[model samples]
Target chain A: MNITVNWGLLAPILAIQLILMVTALTSLYKADATRGPKWMWVLIIVFGQILGPIIYFVVGRNDRS
Target chain B: MRQFGLFYRKEMLEMARSYKWIWVPMVFLLLGVMQPVTTYYMPEILKHAGNMPAGTIITMPTPTAGEVLAQTLNQFGTIGVLVLVLSMMGIVSGERQSGVTSLIFTKPVSFIAYMTAKWASMLTLTAAAFACGYAGACYYTIQLIGSLDVGTVIQAGLMYMLWFVFVISVLLLISAWLPNSAGVAFTTMAFIMLLSFGTSLLSRYLSWSPSRLSTIASEILTKVETLSSVGPVLWISLCSILICVMLAVYRMQSQESISAKA
Candidate 1:
């Protein structure tokens, strides 16, 4: 089972994930308030792949502030 | 019009500050590219799982580029719609609930202008996010699957975008009418799901339903349906969007008195 991985094919997915992560982190840092603890969101954004960052961006921020 | 411009600028600024501009398009781009990449890697993915019986031959036919693009649209139709709705659910109701609407209304703001500004910003955000998603999907599909006609993709994309606009308009109207963001999101999602399900169940009777926009868009890409067949439904959807905008304005005006009470 020596199938070589195609980095070319996987690059876009990685790039998108990186963008989502960075955006989530940036927003979390700037957010005056969040739905829950800031530390929890930081963990989610760092570990949650595509969905983690999205959830934080969508519902985590307390937009009222 | 000047007021609309100022309000739109404010909306855009808010979007930027909230990171909606960055994350929404990124999510769409991710959703777009995932379909083709996953489809391309399914065989490898299955093999690596190592749970299959020995000599389990997987002979899945590769899907055509058109099929892949259509599949991407299906992803957009479901999860993409959910993201858009959730992100925007609080646009009107949140403001109203938090007393921002009352503050704004105390000024010489035109309700119609305010609503139109909101509609414009929603359209801009949805359109840009969708374009990014579709473009990402197209790039991956063409690279991995096969080539597609650019004209066909544009036509299909336009049709699908109309459906998206309809969905956003519904959200805006619900947000304007409802008192809570959760209610706005839930009602909009329910209406969308019910409309699509009902159209499918009653296809013959509801051929002109806005829900058919998604199907027609995919059909255009698949080359199974002509554009002429889509005309009536497209017109119906455009009218529906117009009605939604008008209703949102009317609802917002009425909400003013309620906000006054609060």
Candidate 2:
């Protein structure tokens, strides 16, 4: 069970995921209105991994703003 | 031409404003990286599953670089297609609902120009994002798995992109026909899934279908001999895309007349 983890190979994947999450969260914060409640989106963005932000961007955010 | 340029610029600006410029490529990059990393880590993952009896040996063969790249394309075929479709589903329908289309049409803008402008911008964003993703996938696949022939990779990528172009054109056509964004997304996805499935099930008869582009793309990556037969599929795809754009323009024109009559 002692497989050595290579951070070099894993770092870029982690960074990209972080960037996606942060971008979605920032957009959600700045959005004037959303399809659903703000707190719910925050929870989804935090917990939803790769798909959470995509759903928020696609369906959650209201386009008027 | 001037109106087309103006609309293209505005669409690009809107893409940037909505953070699609950031997130879509990031999503692509993420999807691209996940394939190689997961493939490399599969053995370790199996070990960590913690269900095997002690000393139960598991042997997994390492996949070649071309195979890995082909798998990456498969990833894109599924989730990548869904993301692009969702991002673009509302492009026209949203505008129509919010009265933006009416505002633009009130000007001297031609329907063909408007539709082409939208098509061009969507294609641009898609190309940029896909290139970013595919580059990431290639870099990691070579670094971790093995080296691939650059020429084959590029050829495979272009073939895969034809599939994207066909899907985007379909999106534009559906968006023009439907006033509801949700309906547009649903119908477009259904159309894509049915076509892809049908094409594979009837490959002998449907070889010229644009859906065959994805299969040809993976074949090119795996070093299969497909080049001799790629012509008809390519030309048919290009023709289908042109027809989709024209039909969409005609549909929008008819909708405007209906509204005018009301």
Candidate 3:
């Protein structure tokens, strides 16, 4: 039984992943520092390399501290 | 518990004082009426527009009650809940931000009682606004596009209600951790979108996920999935709610709001 992976369709997946990760990390740094929890940052960085990270930056991160 | 009723009324008064209740329902009412009327007259509207160009064929399709309901749901369904959530996002966390948490905590109110009152009052307000809008839409839809099947209408109404609840629950959690409602609103939508996209990706492996709960009813209506086939989805929704509520309560306890708006 062969479970062949298609890197072609999966190529966009990598690009998508990269974008998600970068954004999440920036958001983690920038998100509401006073209120946002540590794990929330960690989870975004760890789980959402491109998507999660980007989301963290865009949605979760608040640098009002 | 004795103060819960009083607190509820007080909260209700705050809501009434704001007059947001009036505008929200009025906006939703307009949406409800316009959805069907627009859909009903769309072809005629398009036909008139086509006279300006190389004549495009305009086929007038009669608008059905189901379509009107769908249109109403599409235009303003998820949005109204988000508005309500954003408006009340500061309810719990705001006290902390304004340095009033300690003051409130020092009062006769326990965290559980106060939080419960806050949650309950907000939920009531949201329900009233949502029901008014949805009911108005449904009523006008019946008058305009004819009547929906009673069972179907009821089911759809319930499903729409749950959808709003789902949204509010998410925002409620975000609000607990975040000091401001705008952040909560953005975070809620962003979180939901991320969850949706990521869950869809992971659903290739995991048979059940929270995202499925969102799409299940609509899918069932469209014959894309069976009603009973969505049991796992319901279970997932239950689990998500349980986790979110627990986390939100914990966060509210720890959240030291410092008037820090980002």
Candidate 4:
């Protein structure tokens, strides 16, 4: 198997994923409260790939104020 | 105007504090970029999924840059709009339900200022996020698929943004008029879906409908339609937004009595 994965093509996708992950983690770290348990969110953020961070950001935090 | 400024700033701060500033645009950006990337990789993705016959060859026509961008807008039209609705459904009704509106109303606040401030912040968020998402999609489309005319993209984007403004205004109006946030979201979604679907079904009669704005936007991108043809629809949409705001302000003003009865 001589499959060549172009780094140039894949770099932006990786970068976007990284940004999402970091943002989710940072928000989780600083959040005063969330919709559910913080540890569950941490696990979801770590393992959920592209959608995990987005779900965390969208539905996890309880923005009551 | 000063009151509007103060309220707008407060709204911005609330958005920032709630991490809406960070996440909303990021989600849009993700949605925008995903279309082109996934389209470019579809063949390889299918191969990896491993249900292909031994000698089957997949030959798919690579979509034009314009088509890829249109697909991105389609993503926005569905999932992106859903996210915006879910996030913003509580902007007015939720506050009312929580008694925050009562506290704010007791102060010497202009109802117009309050409504306009909410409108302005929603517009800013939508515009900024849409611009980021569309730009990202354009960049990836050009790199992976083909070239598209910048002017066409901008015109289509502006048209789409106008449709978004109209939708958000409808949401704000519903949120103000309804006491339940879930009810507000559902009604807004149903209204939007009906508008789009209904107009498409009766295009000849409803050519001037605001829902046609989405179709006009896509047609502009694909070079199948021109801006001049969309003038009536655009004007109607703008007028509808203005009407929505006025109705929202009126509803908010009467909210005191409504809440008292509730």
Candidate 5:
């Protein structure tokens, strides 16, 4: 099967990366997360790249419990 | 151990009573039933539909039992992983937030034992669901197709269960350690998915990273590879589970260091 994608695909990739980066950096503002939550955020950011950080932003960034 | 059993039974009962446990496995059963039932009748069902485009006919390859199994695993496997992660997301975090841990901790039982029992219960449930769901699909396939190699069927079932168990342990570990179970579960699921996609960009050599358990699970269903040939894959899977469990225990103990503001 021949499959192809245009360079335009890179646009979404770059956009997602930026969104993730911003979310990760902003999470420190939420609450006192202890080292545990903070490390988890970093793990999510590095490993999750886009989705990890995005999910953290949506669900975990609060740290409010 | 008896205490563990008593607690396990109580925990199991509690989990069962909540009705949340029904979410994923039941959906998986539907996926299983849909496999053979859909493949057996999809053409006829489509043909019987009310609207038909003139001169346009829906044509598909006559799906075999293998194809049905493949389709079921691929589809159910993806959704199953998501559901398992999501449902388990709240188990640990909710307990911590609600002071459930304190209730359990005041007892004479070691924290490790309590965590282990809970982890064991979830792991057992995860394995049972994976087995039952796929077993249903396999049995249905045999009913439709007349015969399949029992050895192949059992091997595939075991492989699939192992794949899912590998994933559940990660969630278990994350949920165990993270202050927020739901948050960790969601993040862990996202992490696995992202890793699966990210590895694709790297090399096919790393394609069998434990995160690709879903892909490998489905593939093992349709292909031939002895457990021995798949040893490296299995080893990585085991290692991943072990590391996750260890980290979770470490994290749980570490949680003690967090000042109780609540």
Candidate 6:
């Protein structure tokens, strides 16, 4: 149980998740309209972990709007 | 050919504008990287689960690199497919709903060119994402698990890529035939799940099915698959993809005539 996990080995994974979230959040901010409320998507993108941003990108953003 | 290139470029631009270019591949990379890392840490992960008796030794066989890579493919088969399908579900239906298809139809656009362009763009994105993900998985597997044969990995990757091709083709056909994006997504997901399940349950009767591509890919990784054994499935997959594309093109052409008469 005392095994020390190397942060270096795990950094890239966390970094990728951060990149996804940042991109999703930026897109949400710029969009004038989304499928649902803007705040709801902001919440989802930030709290939805890896899948949060993906869901927002796939279904949340209303391109027609 | 010129018209196809134009439509293909437009589709790619739309994908880039929508940020599909960035996020889809990122998700794939995350999925690919997590698999090998988690497998390498399985013992530590299980040990930290708690409630084990004092001095209880967790004896686990280390999985070979090929096994780890195959497990990565399984991860792609489920979650990777979902992300890819959902991202693509609206390709045709969305354009139709937004009146864009009608607007374009008013011009001298051929439905064949348009449909083929859409299919080609989707296949491009899928191939890029899969390649990035698989390469990441290979690097991590070699570093964390062990070394894998390069030939085996490439062969397995090709087989698995063909499965994605088949799935995307089916999705394209459904999106063309359906009017609603949600419906397109639902039907495609259901059909895929059924095909995968039925293939496994009726493996004897459906050995040549495209659904067998995943199993064949895994077998290749494990060195249990031969070229002759994979030939039928590969041929069937390519043929089905061609059929789906032709059917979708026909659907679009018929719809064009109907709209023109109206």
TM-score of each: 0.96, 0.97, 0.69, 0.92, 0.71, 0.97
On residues B1-262, what C-alpha lDDT tens digit does candidate 5 reach at each position? Answer: 7777877787688566543344345445555755676677666677667688877688897876776787887766577777677656766787788877767666666556666777787787787667667777787778765466677667767777777777777787778767867578677888777776785566366755765555555566667442233667778888887887777777776675353334
Ten contiguous residues minimizing lDDT sum, candidate 3 chain B:
B253-262
Model 1 interface Cα RMSD in Å? 1.7
Alpha carbon lDDT of each predicted model: 0.90, 0.92, 0.60, 0.86, 0.65, 0.92
Give a tens-digit lDDT track for model 1, residues B104-213: 99997999989999989989999999999999999999988889999999999999999999999999988888889989999999999999999889988899999999
Residues A1-65 of candidate 3 have per-residue lDDT tens digits of: 23244454234435535544554454455444624676866775677543344334334533224
DockQ of candidate 1 relative to the true structure = 0.73
Candidate 6 runs further than 4 Å off: A1-3, B53-57, B225-228
Query: What DockQ results do all the predictions give, each relative to the true complex?
Result: 0.73, 0.75, 0.02, 0.45, 0.02, 0.72
Which docking band does candidate 6 fall into?
medium
lDDT of 3 by residue, B1-262 (tens): 7777777787778666544454445445555555665665566566566346675565666856776676677665455544565566666665566666676655556555566666677667767766766776777678656877777666666665665666667776787877665677778878866776786677665446655554554443333444335567667677777677677767766553332221
Best-to-worst lDDT order: 6, 2, 1, 4, 5, 3
Better of 5 and 6 by DockQ: 6
DockQ order of candidates, best first?
2, 1, 6, 4, 5, 3
Q: Over the stretch B110-221, how does candidate 2's per-residue lDDT look in tens digits?
A: 8888999999999998998899999999999999998999999999999999899999999999999988989999999999999999998888889898999999999989
Note each model's CA RMSD in angstroms. Answer: 1.7, 1.4, 15.4, 2.3, 13.1, 1.5
Which scores greater on TM-score, model 3 or model 5?
5
Q: What is the lDDT of candidate 4?
A: 0.86
DockQ of 3: 0.02
lDDT of 4 at A30: 88
lDDT of 6 by residue, B171-248 (tens): 999998999999998999999999999989988888888989998898888776443367788899999999999999
Error of 4 at B253 (Å): 0.5
